[model samples]
Each structure stands twice: as C-alpha cells, then as structure tokens.
Target: MGYFKDILKYEKKYRRFTVLNIVFNILYAFFNVLSVLAFIPVLNILFGAEKRVIDKPEYNNISDLGNYLEGSFNYFISQKIISEGEIKALSLICIISLSLFFFKNFFRYLASYVITFLRTGIVKDLRDNLYHKIVELPISYFSEKRKGDIIARMTSDVQEVEVSILTSIETLVREPLTVIISIGIMLFMSVKLTLFVFILLPVSGFIISSISKKLKAKSIKAQKETGTFLSFIEETLTGLRIIKGFNAENVIEKKFNNSTLSFKQLMTSVFHRQTLASPMSEFLGSATIITILWFGGTEVLNNTSTLEAGKFMGYIVLFYTVLNPIKLITTTFYNIQKGEASAERIMSVLNTKNEIKDLPNANAKEGFNDKIEFKNISFKYKKEYVLKDFSLTINKGETVALVGQSGSGKSTLANLITRFYDVNKGEVLIDGQNIKSITKKSLRGLMGIVSQDSILFNDTVENNIKLGSQNASHDAIKEASEIANAAEFIEDLPEKYLTNIGDSGNTLSGGQKQRLSIARAVLKNPPIMILDEATSALDTESEQLVQVALEKMMQNRTSLVIAHRLSTIQKANLIVVMKKGEIVEQGKHEELLAKKGEYFKLVTMQSLS
Candidate 1:
C-alpha cells in the first residue's frame, strides 16, 4: 500500500480522468445493487402471494425505512394486479428491470473507459522518468549495473506494473463499492443472516491474505530472473562472433535454460497462489449462502422473522450477487501484492539521488580561455588511486600528448578535463576556475570527444556527421567530411550523405566509422578536443589516413591526445610519458629519445614487437 501511495504521485498529472473514473464507478456500484433488488416484484407476481393495501404507508423513522418501502412496494404491486390485472403488473416490472440492467452496464463501461487514460498515462510517465534518470546518472552508476537488468526494468517490469497494478484500477475502486452496497441491502433484508455473513468473512479474508503474503517476494525473484536471461541475450548478441568462434553455444544455451527454469519455478508458485484466490473466495461465499438459507428458512417456518418469502428469495439472490465482487476484490488484492514488487523496483531507480548534479548557482562556462590545469589531483574508481598527486598544465591552442601503458592514468586526465568524473582531491581547473563550479552541459559543450569505439547510430551519413551540430547546413557537413578524408568514400556510397548506415554503422569499414566520428567532432568545431586512443584500433593504412584527418582537425585547437602508438605523437608540442599513474619523463620526442628513458623504452618495445 505504501508503494501504491508512491505510484499515485504520477496520477496527479491526470487528476481529471481519475475523478471521472471514481464518479462512474460509484454510479456503477449503486446501480449494481438496484438491479438485483429490482427482481423482487417479479418474484412476487410469479409466486401468487401478493399483498394489497388500501392506504399508503407513513414514514416515521429512518431505521424502519427498509421495511416501510418493502411493504409500500408490495401494496402498490398488489393494487396494480387487482385493477389492471397481472399483464400490466408483469409489463411494469419488466420495464423497471430492463432500465436497471441497461444503466448498470452503461456505467460499468464508462468506468472502464475513463480508467484507460490513467492506465496508459501513468505507464508513459513512468517510462519517461526512468529514461531521464538513466541518461542523467553518471557513467559510474552503470559500472556495477547490468545493461539487460536496466532494460528489463524499463520494459517488462513497467509492463508488469501496468498489468498487475494499473489495469486493476477499476476493480480497486468499483468492487469494494459493490461489496459495501450489497452488504447494506443484505442487512436491510435480514440482520441475523447479515451478522452470520460478517462472522465468516473475516476468516475468509485471513485465508486469502495468508496465501498472497509471499507473492511479492516470489514475484520479485521471477522478475530478476527475467532480467538475468535478457542480459545474457544482449551479451550473446553483441559477442556472437566470439561465441561462435569459441564454439560456446551449448554452454550459453544451458546457462539461459537454467535461468528460465528458475523463473518458471518462481512464477509457478506465484500464479498458483494467485489462482487459488477465486475458488477459495467462491467456496467461502457458497458456504455462507447455504448457512443463510438454512437459518432464514427456519425463521420463516417458525415465525421468528418478519421477512416475506419473496423478499427472502430476493435477499438470497442479492447475496449471491455479492460473491462475484468479493471474489474479484480478492483476486485484485493478490495482483496488487505481486505488482508491489515491480513498483518497488521502479521507485528504486526513480528515488535514487544522482551524486553528480549541477549546483543551483553554478557558472556556465561558454568557452575556454587560459590554460587547463590539474592541480595535485588524486582520483580513484575504487579503493586504489588511479591518478595520485598528478599535476599538469596545457595552455590555450596547444597539443599535449599523453603516452602510457594501459591503466597508467592517461585516459583519467581526459575524463577529469571533461568533468565525466570529478577529482576525489584537489581540482581540475579551466582558465584558473575549478571545473566543478561550471555547469556540466556548458563544460562539455566546449569540447568534442572521439573515443576508440567510434560509436554511431543507424542513421544517414549526413545525420551522423551533423549529430552534435544538428542545425548545420549541407555545405558544413560536406566540408567536415572532406576535412576527415571521408568525402571520397561517402560520395561513392549509394546515396552519399543520404545513405543509411546499418546498426552502429556496420555497413561502413572501421576506418570509415572512425572518420565519421572525426567528422562529427569537426562539424561541432569546438575549441577543445579530446581524442582518447582515437586510432589505436586501426590498421597501418587506415591509421595513416585517420592520422592525417586528426592532424587537420587539431589545427589551432587545445587538444589532449591519449594514444598507445608512439608514431602518432612524434610531432606533438609536448609528449609526457607515464608509468604506474605518475609521470616518468616529459620532453620532445627527440629529447626523450636522447635520454633513453621510459618513452624511449616504449618506442623501442613497439619497434621490436
């Protein structure tokens, strides 16, 4: 129920629709009771036990109002039969019953119709908020989370919340109202029989509650298994080449089968308990009906109760009507219990506080001016520091290349400069101001990054090049592509700039993808460029071409080049060689070679290998 309260926050946006549903459900419940009660007159006409009265009854108190109305209705029907005969009386009862039935279904349909807005609206808002959070959270947040689990939370888990929670909105409101109205009428018909029903209902409710007590826990387990298999599928698809090369299909299939087996077992328990709700409730309701018939019939025979035979029969029919609502309410309760697990999973993500957020008064840095400085910054992704007491300075419009073995803190500097992750100690400053004080959007806006992977979506060549500068003109995209040496091949494509690259630009070669990524950065035309191993994954011919494009893009731009290949950084203004998260040597390529230090060893090693 607490989770239900949290979910209602999304409902505030669609309050008008919610109110309409409530109003219609109320009408439906009211008419549901009236339709059953309307059958009493027809029962009397058929039984041939109609009572006639010459005078109209007087209303004295509210307590006897039920009996007074019952007698008055019987008297009017008796006179109708005496004056106009059974034909007119029968037609009149038929008309009243038909009207009640029509409105009962009409209001029921209206309730369902109004609830559609809430059901779909809440799911949409939930998905929107989840996606916003996924994008806004820092990259470190995803380092420990499985991508498939997040996808499951966003897709199937949300759908479960809809099926098990939001879809039951009508039953949650209407069924209880139906039960209350039916109970009230039962009490009016015979207090003793109604009292007997009250005695048995709590016991029945306790049994249903007990069965569903473990449903939420089981449901959570099933959903987690769903995520596990989905993650396996995502991983398998992404690495299909590796899997097939290794001949690991059977291993992967067996692991997936185990996960599905666990999910199937858990869901079996959850659904079995859920399925028991209806039959158990119906059985209890039938038992209550049989008891009421025996007691009410005994009272009528011994003359201890004032209920007429026709009214008692109608009372029994009305009580039977109450059973379906009770069963539906019980079923809805079980569904909510299961849905609470999904709601908790969703709210966990929504309620998480992002550790990285812009300050209320943070300054927006539109452009770089002076030097970019790392002032004794110590940082770590975990327990051990990746960069400890590291300090460097690069002036405006300078190219500084960082060369190191993997895990030597070269890439960490690029991340720090871009504010992807903040320093645990000291500061990363742009133009003598701490980068933390700058709004992240504005800070990253001044720089263009080309990573090793050359990530590209499935879109046109023009659209991929103009990703950052979406409003750039056709001539600008063409110029950027030419600058990256991609225009020659792109122009040879089927549609050139209008060509649709397949998934992740798989239709293009590695060199083409990397060039497209470079073209994107060139189109943005930012002052600062961070090329993190931009050409480390290419062949000799592709590397040479990409190197030419990289040099052209780096003209007069403040660039931080992280590279493994020593040939690429030979002409950099300053080359820093790093070992074990600390700088080992810093000088020109010729100067470092003359010293025969760490940079010299790297060059010699690459030359040997």
Candidate 2:
C-alpha cells in the first residue's frame, strides 16, 4: 500500500482522466444496482404477488422516502394493470430493466475508456523518468549493478506494474462502489440478515487474505529471477563467440535452464495463490447464499419477518450482485499485492540518489584558459586508493602523455578531469576555478574524450561524427573527418557519410572506428582533449594510421594522452611515467631517455629505446 501510494503520485498529471473515470464508475455502480432492483416488480407481476394500491402515495421526508416510493410504484402498476393488460405491465417492467442494464454497461465502458488514458499515461511517464534517471546516474553506479537487471526494471518490472497495479485501478474504483450501493440496499431490506452477512463475509475475507499473504514475497522473488535470466541472456549474447570457442554451450544452457526453472516454481506459487481467489470467493459466496436461503426463507414462510416473497427474492439477487464485486475486490487486492513488488523495484531506481549533480549556485564555464590542474587529488573506486596525492598540470596547447602499466591509474585521470568521478580529497581546477563549482554540462563541454573502446551507436556515420556537435553542418563533418584521416574509408563505404554503422560500429574496421572516434572529437572542437589508449587495440598498420590522425587532432589542442605504447608518445611535449598510483618521472622524451630512470625502463621494456 505504501508503494501503491507512491505510484499514484505519477497520476497527478492525469487527474482529469482519473476524475472522469471515477464519475463514470459511480454512475455505473448506481445503475448496476438499479438494474437488479428493476427485476423486483417483474417478479411480483409474474407471480401474482403484487399488492394492490388504489390511492397514490404522498411526498414525504427522507425517513419515509423508501416506503413512499414503494407505495407510489405499486399504485402506478395497479393503474397500468387496469388500463392495460398484465402482459403489457410485465412488458413495461422488462423495458425498464433492459434500459437500466443498457446504461450500466454503457457507463462501465465509459469508465474503462477514460481510464485508459490515465493508465497508459502513467506507464509512459514512469518509463521516461526511469530512463532519464539511468542516464543521469554516475558511471560508478553502473559499475556496481548488472546492466540486464536495470533493463529488467525498465521493461519487465514496469510492465508488471501496469499489469498488476494499473489494470486493477478500474476494479478498485468501480467494484467498491458497487459493493457499497448493493449492501446499503440489502441492509434496507433486512438489517438482521445484512448483519449476519457482514459476519460471514469477514470470515471468508480472512481466509482469502491469509492465502495471499505470502504472494508479495513470492512475486518479488519471481521478478528478481526474471532479472537474473535476462542478465544471463544479455551476457550470453555479448559473449556468444567466447562461449562457442570455449565449447561451453552446455554449461551456459544448463545455467539458463536453472534460472527459468526457479522462475517457474516461484511464478507457479504466485499464480496458484492468485487464481485461488476466484474459486474460493465463489464457493464462499455460494455458502453464504445457502445459509441466507435457510434463514431468510424460514422467516418468510413462518410469517416472522417483514420481507414478502417477491422483495425477498430481490434481496437475494441484490446480495448476489454484492458477491461478484466482493470477489473482484479480493482479486484486485491480490493483484495490488503482486504489483507492489514491481512498484518497489521501479521506485528503487527512480528514488536512487544521484551523488553527482550540479551545485545549486554552480556557474557555467564556457572555455578553458591557462592550464588544467589536479591539485593533490586522492580518489578511490571502493576501499583502496586508485590515485593518492596525484598532482599534475597541463598548459594550453600542450600534449602531456601519461604512460603506465595497466593498473597505473592513467584512465582515472581522464575520469577526474571530466568530473565522471569527483576526487575523494583535494580539487580539480580548470584555469583557476574548482571543477566542482562549474556546471557539469559546461565543464564537460570544454573537453572531448576518445576512450579505448569506440563507443558509437547504431546510426549513420555522419550522425555518429556529429553526435556531441549535433548542429554541425555537412561541410563541417566532412572537414573534421578529413582532418582525422577517416574520410578515406568513409568515402569508400556504400552510403558514404549516410552509411549506417552496425551496433557499436562493429561493421567498421579497428582503425576506421578509431578514426571515426577521433573525427567525433574533432567535430566537437573542445579546447582540451583526453585520448585514453585511443590506438592501443589496433594492428601495427592501423596504429600508424590512427596515430597520424591522433597527432593531427592533437595539434594546437590541450591534450591529455593516456598511452601504453611508449613509441606513440615520443613526440609528446611532456611524458609522465606512473607506477601504482603516483608519478615516478616527468620530462621531455629525450630528457627522460637521458635520465635512464623509470621512463627509461618502460621504454626499454617495450623495446623502443
């Protein structure tokens, strides 16, 4: 119920649709009861049980209103029987019942129709909000979570919320009103009987509720297992070549089967408990009806109660009407319990605190000048420090290369400069301003990054190049491509710039993909460029091609080049050699060779001296 209330907060925008749905449901409930009550006069007329009333009943106060209306209806029927035939009177009663039923169904449809807007609108907003949150959360958050699990919350969990929570909304609104109206009339017919009904109903409700008590816990488990299998599928698709090459298909298959089996068992329990609501409520309702027949029938037969035969039959029919809604309400309750699990999962993501965000008074930084400085910054991903007391500075138009072993924290510098992860201690300053005090968009706007992996979407080559600079004209894109040495291959492609690159740009060769990445950076034309192992994965031929483009793009740019290949950084203005988390040496390439220190050892290890 707490989760349900949270979900309803998204309904604020669709209040008009919600209001219209409620109004129509109210009318539907009213006419639904009236339709059953209309059968009373028909039963009396058919059975020759109607009492004659020669005098018309008078208008009266609220307390006498019930009897006054009954007497007035009796007088009108008597005149109809006298003026017309009994058959015509029966026809009139049937016509009234048919019309009541018509309006009941019509308004029921209207309620469903209007609620569609609210239901679908909320689902859309929930997905949109979840996606936006996912995009805004820090990269560290994803490093701690499974991509497939997050995807499950976005797709399946949200869909579960729609199925389990939202679909029950109409029943929640309509059925309760039906139950209330029908019960009110039943109480009017016989207080003693209605009170007895109240006792029996709660007992049945208690039993039904006890059965569904564990449904939510099971549903949560089931939804979680869904995420597990989805994660497996995503991993399998991503690593299918490895799986096949290793001949581990059977292992992967058995693991997936186990996940599905567990999901099956949990869902089996959830659905069995859910399906029990219908038959249990129906059986309980039948038991209550039989008991009422015994008690009410005995009183009517022995002349011990106010209920006559026809009105007593109508009372039985009215109680039956209440039973259906009570069953639906119980089912709705079960569904809400099931949906609460999914709602909790969704709310968990939407409610996640983004640790990285712009400060309220943060200023937008438009350009970089002088130097980019890391002032004694200490940072860590988890427990141990990745960068401890790390300090460095890169002046404008200088290409400073960070050369290190794999765990030497070369890439962490790029992350820090871009504000991807704020330092645990000290500050990163652009020019002289603390990077934290700059709006993140503006801070990132001043630098362009080309990482080890070519992160391109499945889109046109032109669109991929124009990603950050979306408003770049065709000539600008071509010029940037030509500058990065990508125009050669791009022009050779089937559709040239308009060509669609496959997923992650898998269709492009390694060198071509890296050049496109460089072209994308060139198009953004940022003052500071961070190229983190941008050509580390290429073949020697491809490396040379990409290296040429890298030099071309780094010309006149304040560049931070994180590299593993010592040969590539030989021409860099400054080379900083790092081991563990600290810088061991910094010098011009020739000066470092003369030092014969850690930088010299790295060059010797790479056989580049």
Q: 265-352, model 2: which lDDT tens digit per residue?
A: 9999999999999999999999999999899999999999888877888899999999999989999899999999999999998999
Best by lDDT: 2
lDDT score of residue 357 within candidate 1? 81
The TM-score, computed over Cα atoms with residue i paired to residue i, of candidate 2 is 0.98
Superposition error at 161 for model 1 (Å): 0.3
State the lDDT at 468 in candidate 2.
Answer: 97
Best model per TM-score: 2
- Each prediction's Cα lDDT score? 0.89, 0.92
For all predicted structures, in order, the TM-scores are: 0.97, 0.98
Candidate 1 regions with alpha-carbon error over 4 angstroms: 59-68
Model 2 residue 522 CA deviation (Å) reads: 0.6
Poorest 10 consecutive residues of model 1 by lDDT? 45-54
